[model samples]
Target: MSGSGIGHDQWKTRFGFMLAAMGSAVGLGNIWRFSYVAGESGGATFLLIYLFFVLIIGIPLLLTEFSIGKAGQMDAVGSFKRLAPNTKWHLTGLMGVIGGILILSFYSVVSGWTLFYLYQYVTGAYWTEPDGGFGAAFEAWTSNPVAPLFWQALFLGLTILIVMRGIKKGIEKANNLLMPALAILLIFMAVYGLTLDGASEGLAFLFTPDWSMLTEPSVYFMALGQAFFSLSIGICGMLTYSSYLKAKDRLPAATVGIGLMDTVFALIAGVMIFTAVFSYGVEPDSGPPLVFIILPSIFEGMPAGHIVGIVFFVLLTMAAFSSALSLLELPVAYVHRTLGLTRKAATLIMGSIIFVLGIAASLGFGVWSHIQINGNNILDMMDNITANVILPLGGLLMAIFVGWYLNRNQAINNSEIESPILQKVWYNIVRFLVPVVMIVILFISLFDI
Candidate 1:
């Protein structure tokens, strides 16, 4: 029952496992980046392509990650080592381990920004009418060296504390509350948003596809990236969580459920945000700025602006928190198992290191703005390097290893699904479609060719 010599904890219930996996999948990327990317990539067309990729690429890859962890019952790196001892396949897990740490470093920095904005909303700072508008307010907040670092450290500390508590008490329980509450809040926002003046236009913008945009290659590339990123794949977060699962636990159901729920959450959040954006008469293609700069203005102009602002930011933070927990867990699980450190000790050590890295990311926004790698700031560089380079590469290796390296019978047996036909479909996807699509996405992401 232990991947390493040390015993592991099982999720107390089936629902608990689902909640944890879903929580990991549904993160800030789903709500914030999904909306903006969908807008920039041609609205409904992007949504269609994204879902297609999720079905073909994301779900199959998700099952591959789950099977690896469940079958090996180890942390990401050890999972590979256990699955295929005396082989280089374990390098995929190593990449995932490093990618997890890298992603969380910048991720916590942005999560910290969410916390700051949540505080601003609670204090009526951003809700009240401002002379320079929400854009200026966001600039002022993000550009402040001390405040951003404080919030980043605070968020990292909170994430560390949760991981310190171990699986059942910490990760499972938090998701049980957070995911459902997030869903309710998002629905409330969407319902309210639909009632806004520009609801028709917003819905049209979201549901109506611009056919010509789909002809471009970049749309497919971006959709593929979004599908992978939105599911929290390629970073070993899913693999880490699934490692704690019991053998009897059915992975295919979990995989499909998580994939569907995560995509649904993003679509719901996208519509909610777009409704507000269209209502405010602003362009939806504002990229990342749409969340911080544009959304605040939308909230401020709405009825009960203060109340909506508070709820919105709170939802954002909750989403970020859930995702951050999984990211932190991957490296902590590795350190805990390999070094034989207590969960608390491993969490503290890894969390401290990540906090320090996060500090540099925070400073890159202001004090160290001059510091640039290949014309990108530290934060942007970390993001691009991980998302564009590391994640896809990890995913590519995973697809190849799971599809080709691992025995077909082993993967199907570990999946715990009874349907032979379904297993065949999953294997074909992992073997053929995923690797090819991932290569295209990776090349486009890195060289921009």
Candidate 2:
């Protein structure tokens, strides 16, 4: 294949396509961020409002992305340029592609954390650990740069391998197995966690509103931001996945499937974490270290800590890989389409370059720990741009493009996506409610509200 462009393959089935899309959207963000934000908000109250924004803002925008991708059968670059006729819409694709680059750099670092745990598990490390070792271990891992970088490259390379296998054998095959397996593992973990003695306190903490926490105006805005971020909105992942969609698939239904799945997983993580922490009479809001610090302690004294530890980390690694592969792919596909590079060439070349870049992100953990412009490290910087800037803007643009630029009926029903009353609801949100909410979110985010 040399420098030649890669071949594009259609999804094997509509179901496979749905799994791939959902797999990307329903990864770490949903599992970790959503419930925490929900807890910070008025819990059930925020959940209701979030449901509104998700269906309206998340689903409609998602449909728009997919519709654009399938309509042009093009990557982000070609899709917009084709639609707007010399307008700047096409450049948004470049923005999305670059955002992927920025995200993957730091993203892999965290994924590396999962990998390190996996290694520890196989070695029976967690099984032999002291009660408080989990926190110290996590500290040792992050406080040093070397370990983060090594595992980050390992994670990124794994992601590239799956993508380079092409869509059918790679994305579709892997997600079909991985997503359901992930769900199953989480459920088992949740059940096991429920049995733990300390799990109830965490549950109470998670479900309790603490309405006093609602005083900050930023809380609501942050809730909306979390909902978007957790669902992988505004990243063009939705758009890119839709690019592979067949016309026969109902765009609305597919989006609903993906959105609901994303929401479900987040809530499940909440329950899983809640049961474990509360059972042990431990508080859950321990922050950042919640996953690394809390879960390992909970599992260590369990009957099969080594087995569960291995399973947990393996599942997390796979989840990270699924999302990262899709992230890397957005740009690789663009490179192939716009620059005419082959899939293998794109994967290997881009993969290698990103692999090296991953080192900088990995180093941010320890040796390069001193590097910071505004007290933000590489991962923090990348997350800020993608979540606060690039993503919201993309979502905002999609709402405008779908609601204003194109004929309403044609733009929406054009995909022939099913879902009756809900579609109308999404239409209304896209037209009025979501835009207003998102505009407020954009403004609030600008000032760090």
Candidate 3:
């Protein structure tokens, strides 16, 4: 294959495609956000609801994206334009392209934090901090305007270098190495963390249900949002990735496999995080800093502490890297295909724009601290806009377009599933359940309605 060509690539194999999709789905959100959301939403109850959303909503949307991409044989925006020509359905793809860009803006900021912490762990910087000092250290780091921007630029530079190499060489090869290493490291960390004295308490906190908490409407909305966002469904990168798939690949099986693996990774991360929470008596729902702040404090008290810290932070960076690559690729794919730019040129352009946006997010913690949209600073505002509004809006459009706009027989035929009964069930979920649930959550989240 020619290195810079736009429309001339296929994944090397089915395994490669699935692993790439899974890598995109499983990221920093799985560890930091999922664990906190699960804890705040009532643990086992939240898990059950999240799994329901994953199966009923996530899997079908995954298949929908794969089917559209494979049949259309184009990038996310081009796929819609190809599939339903002369219609507004392509706007769904546009939302995804823009959404991916918005997501990366702030995502890189957090990824920068992970990169900085990885540096600290590797250099034994954490060793010098006083006991129970990670929270202060993290605050100090974020509140420093120049340092976070430096890290964000460094992280975005790494992401751009990988993506500039073209799809098969850049995306597929990176995921092939990184995803397996991530899975193995997560399992090891989970098992080791469980050896702590308060493991039982952690287990109970995760598995034991507080049924009364289910009455809170916020938990339902939270679980549903996590279900959609955690799988990387609404962001449009999945469609771009699957656009590289060959027709021989089974969409149904691939979708389910990716969803299951992503969910399992999040669960395992919860094990690692919550065990440390209970052992160290750290607050479980301490929000976004649980992994960066609390986990480091927990590690400080463990034997072979620095080694464990290095492994954990490295795993976190890998997770962030995998997802950020996909985010960067979404716009790159669009620009390369739609605007006639070379893949490398598109990648560099999009990466640079996202890096510039990330500087604002980085400064939101320090220089721009006084500015707020509804009391959220720049980073949190970017996160809120993308996660709360754009994602669900994109997802809502995707469900409707796949469920209602596209021809049913074509969708079924394109999906390449073997079972007739399963096809009917998938169609119903996409058409009805997914749209209703997505709109409800989107309204509640965006408007507090």
Candidate 4:
């Protein structure tokens, strides 16, 4: 196979590539979404199942994406095209590019919310709660129509600036800094949270399992979905990142590192958030409002609450920003590779278009609140379509392409699995197990079953 004509920018080191991949995997899905989903899904029971899925399913798929990218050495779409010339396999990569763009559009809007809260904490503005408290304050701000747009633009602009600088200097350097800061802040908060009065209850809630809930099929489905989404698999972000790696870099070790870090981060976030919630006597299953609404109220009453609030939002924003970099990079890489644009030009054009698209989602909370698709607002609809439909389908096709269609010897070589026994285990899981699970997830998500 011939290389894509565009010059490839490689990761300066294996450590840099691992951090970038972990940054892509460890985002709002782990911190913000994971908390609420676990709360509603039966806490420790869901965590057990989620761990099962991550090990049995997530790591295998992660390795699959890494193998494809390292082997093809191109942008997501270009990789498939180069690997399987004249076939429709590239469509899977195209779907990933589109999914990345759409996910970033709505994703930036929420990330902007984190920035808003962070700013409020820094300025001490949150100390003086609005008339009805943080809940009302959250509602009023989201419904303002204009305020959210500014934050969204600012957040997306930051992402564009980082990605525009190219791989090593921009994306890798930023992750090296942001990810460590995020980890420290998270660990500090979790430790502090454990010292609170309700720490015991929070631990119980998170660690105690309701084994009977295992009988409910939805628990398995939610775990499967969370495992897939949290790792940022099927979006081509991993594929694009891994393409920068040298052939000597170990794919299996990197996959394990990214997966382990992401899962451990989510568990710590759960401990941090839940201990605080239980301490303040707030409802654990507060749904989406838990972060923006409920947390502020709880913080207001805590000792040195203002400082803690600032740290929490900072952690949240860093997590979101790190992930957003990968999301934006996926499309930027595509445009640069396939369209023959310079990296700067592709970043500018794609970043600008995504910012414009995100305005609709920002407005959805306010001016466009009445507009609904299948009972979901614009932002929710975009998230549902991409997360529930596009990502799963992309993942399914990727599994089939790599597991069944790609040359077996090439796949094995790309995976870098030295042991024949381990190689067979990974291969059969990707070939047999992943496809079956993905189909079940698609069925459950589509029919709302």
Candidate 5:
């Protein structure tokens, strides 16, 4: 494989790179997962804490990843090897690659569900409302071993096709198309939700913070985890994406833009979901089933709800697709560069293997439901392992490497922050605060304390 230089694929424009990076950050986490977690954690208070973490922790780590990628100018693993030659820092990159693969395995299963929901809407099948309620319908459909697997395969196939086309033509182009569409869809839905009868209640629930919850330790823990996960920093997806960027790219501006857009998308998604939930008299803290069961049921009862249902699912599928592309691209970049394989060959090989792994995740909701790891079903087991364990560990190691090992001046220069004050602030956070908080998160996730 070639080293970081003119040999690497470069982003065509700064805007394109921003969109692609934002696409990675604003996935199902923003909409599906963000909504439920926010609801469960105490809507307004949780959001406040989440934003705090994003500002202090998320942006610093994001800049760290960007700096690493730009300086190394190679795939995730190659970048580490290039930067810290003869050191084991590359193992962190390897861990990130593994985390990406594991995350996408179960992530694809959920994205497949989004596609299936989209198909149901487009075909007008959702209007019929089966014998059991939407809750029962979702349970039955997900539990059907064959059906979920088919959708999962289809979703993974789409991701593979995009990655195989290479960066400028495949990944960048797809994000350029999908990210704007997702934004428009989200804004439109949020506006529509405002017209509902329960808009007031939904708004209050999402924006009015309860100071009491601020003292809760679990709230802070969940917020920190969400900030890391939502920013897509820990898995080296940002590092891999930034590897394609030119030296002139402004890392700070891109970091802020991506982080702000991601947070706003989550808030808007909360508004859209909670408004519909309240308007339809459904519970706000409905957990994971909030999107699959609660929202669909709400859509069925609203006027012109079928059209809204189509739009909602279409938005969801786009968000999931954009994120999945980045996840798959992480491993694809590593394999293509390290193994000396063509992008097409690498994508196909990695994509096929991930698909096979996702089949087990899909079965977990059905036939494999009986199987549990630490009380989590198959899919949940994968999610917990990656999100809780692998991702936090990876992020922690990255902070340590950047803060303690990387050349301080070179790291600051790579960050592209002009203000000396801000530079010191960022360096210290990544060096000190970030590692401590990440350790706490890792410990909590491991022991479930």
Candidate 6:
């Protein structure tokens, strides 16, 4: 079963398959970004809209990516070329490859913070009662570019090592344990959080809809963007992951599983964060400050603070690694499939390149402040380019490819199951709604409020 033959193969089991897919979908994007996006928008109202878009837009996009990749049986670049045949549509896959590498260059830097903080938790650094120590520690480290660079390299190396170990032995095995641990840790956090005095208020904020937020044009656009990013659509991870998937598996079922799992992570992270933040009476809109500054300070007072903080960051670190593993795999899979490089050689080259480029992203807080573009730091620029630009544009291009270019119904019929009506509805949504939604959101993201 484990024989190597250019060895492009499916996941070993349904459990392994679920862990890999869910691991890709659940990440820092769910914990930090989802809470911030929800907090920045009108909380529950935005979440509801985001969920709606996730069903209509995210699900179809996920299906298209899976079906296309399964059809091509190759990574992003190779797969696009196979499906499109001699046109520039393949470049969309190139954009996805580049975007994955570029995004992870900064993403790993942030992930390092979780790992760093976890060590601090074990060492009791965050629980020290010095005034402003929490923010001060984060600020001082980031202000020194070399510290973040070192940590980013550490995180990158860890991910590369796992990928080099082969899918089942390394990636699947680690995530199987880590994903369950993360979910359990989150449940513990939520239960602990509910005991705090402000828990009820936070729940209200998270669950109650503030429909008037819909009156603003940007709110809708923000919801769409969050939905897209949260579900990991147009990232090439899904496309690449599915290319290696078993041909006989149902694409729609896998997409649904991924979507639901992604949503679960976000909701659970919300509970974990709200409990801590509202308990401290901290403002939710403190932006990135909430995670680094507030959480540390809150941890100072909690019983068994060090142990809890350690577990929390462990959850974060696992989430980060799982997502990073998928992203790094995209280009390596492409190289192996197209240029015929060994997986090891491809991983080393791609990982090394990403490590070097990542220094600039790590430096953004201090030495590279002058290098800002559009008043955004290196991280912001990378995220905006990937999230607001490449992804939606990728999604738009994918919509065109799947809807106009591919015989999507045949694609659907090939993997068809019991629900012909649902299949037809999915086809229609991908055909009409997703492209329309992407266009509107892209327009708003480009020029509007």
Which structure among the candidates has the greatest lDDT?
A: 4
Residues 113-204, candidate 4, lDDT per residue (tens digit)? 99999999999989666688898898899888889889999999999999999999999999999988988998999888888998889889
Tens-place lDDT per residue, model 6, 281-358, is 887877654677778788778887777778788888989899898889888887776777788888988999888877
Tens-place lDDT per residue, model 1, 102-138, is 8888889889989988998887778775777877877
Clashing pairs in 3: none
Backbone clash pairs for candidate 5 read: none
Clashes of each: 0, 20, 0, 0, 0, 0
Which residue ranges in model 5 land beyond 4 Å of their true spot? 1-7, 441-448
Q: Give TM per candidate.
A: 0.96, 0.91, 0.95, 0.96, 0.96, 0.95
**CA error at residue 359 for candidate 3, angstroms:** 1.1
Of candidate 2, the 10-residue stretch with the lowest lDDT total is 1-10
> What's the lDDT of the predicted structure labeled candidate 4?
0.88
lDDT tens per residue, model 2, 85-104: 77888777888887777777
lDDT over C-alpha atoms for residue 218 of model 2: 66
What are the per-residue Cα lDDT tens digits for candidate 5 across 239-331?
A: 999999877777898889999999888888888898888888877787876899988888888899999999999999999999999999999
lDDT by residue for model 3 (1-449), tens: 12322465788989998888888999977987898778767788888778888888878888877777777778888888878989988888888888899889888999989998889988788955655488888888898978888888899999999988867898899999999999889888988988898988888888888888777667777777787778998767898888887766768788889999999998888877887889889778777677878888778889987889899888989998999989998899889877888888998899989988888888888878998877679877777677667776777788788788877897788777779999898888889998887777666655653
Better of 4 and 6 by lDDT: 4
